[model samples]
Target: GVPLSTNEDSTRNQNLAALYVLPQTSYPTFYDVRLFIDPGYTEAFHGNVSIRIIPNINIDQITIHAMAMRIDSIRVVSDVNPNEDLFSDFTLATDDTHLLTIRLTRNITALQPHVIHIDYVAQYADDMFGVYVSTYEENGRTVNLVTSQLQPTFARRAFPCYDEPALKAVFRTTIYAPAAYATVRSNTPERRDSLKPNEPGYVKHEFEDTLVMSTYLIAYLVSNFNYI
Candidate 1:
């Protein structure tokens, strides 16, 4: 039986959580996993990424998830001759979720396209940002508190993709998480979100996209958190 346990190492656990190991079959073997990126804010962006190809695989299905942003265009710049623009036949809009899939029609001679580039902006959210706290008092007053992992849930929540790390993609996430929240985190250290004053219970968190990574590895936890 496959071993199962709660993940402890934040980094290693994040990678493991993003992967799905399937059972062996009688014939050929292939694995299909979804991928996502948070293109924070950039006019032009480019990235190179790689994925380990499992032996005995015949094909790979590549899908891109872009939601709530304007995708002026997308083009396949490598791997194939003639540089095909595959985005035309692809689906651009989802029920508030944007998902596009492309089958690698040809065998890959090199690891490319596995690294993708994206350009987009981060929009604001009403429900996407908020403070939910659980508190208790020592003597009839409240003291303890808790906050949401709004980065993965709120920030990326607006968009739809694999939303994990093992399915790493060159993520370029530019958006507003919130202002009251001091810090934000992504797969890469590219840019930071800006803060501005707003109505009650409102702020902004704008950051740059992330590095090449699986969907699940894309994570952010915001709050006054102290790790032991």
Candidate 2:
């Protein structure tokens, strides 16, 4: 979480346990996420997420959760400034800080909204959490399937976001996948045209915006599996 106060702030208690919890300086209101995954050709997937957040107080740093991924870029957009922020991750570091910290040159005003944009890439998880690939036999050949089980705290492994248990936001998600051989499913049914000239042989599945909900409740699946 972002450091909202300096050590001299006597009103704030710097307890030892505070290190384990995220500071609620800024919280997410919405998430717009797009993903491209072709399980037939690669194990890694690419994604871009834009998050809308509101600051509870003027803050110079923003921290959110992420794990086991490469964030190619991150930027904060607002009337104040549109430049990118310097960011670092401690997902695998000794502090057990799966937090992504973005240092800002200017402070974000309290109650003002801004968008945090990030581009990232990560391999499909083998563990049951987050977005992952599973296999099944279809006509004597192994077939790859993509699915998610983002309950509790695993959504960070899928996309960078405010991942605390109580943090909730509206989510709008999209997926680009093989058109002819794949079926996509999400919380809502809002599939669109299947072909794009720029993305040949791929289909677009844009889900409707979710209700105000926790990140863990966001779910999706990509495969040729039958819809039941």
> Backbone clashes per model, in order?
34, 0
> What is the C-alpha lDDT profile of model 1 across 59-114, one tens digit per residue?
34445444444443333334444455333334554554444443444543333333
Q: What is each predicted model's overall lDDT from 0 to 1?
A: 0.36, 0.79
> If scored against the real structure, what TM-score would every candidate get?
0.36, 0.83
Best model number under lDDT:
2
C-alpha RMSD by candidate, in order: 12.9, 6.8
Q: Who wins the TM-score comparison?
A: 2
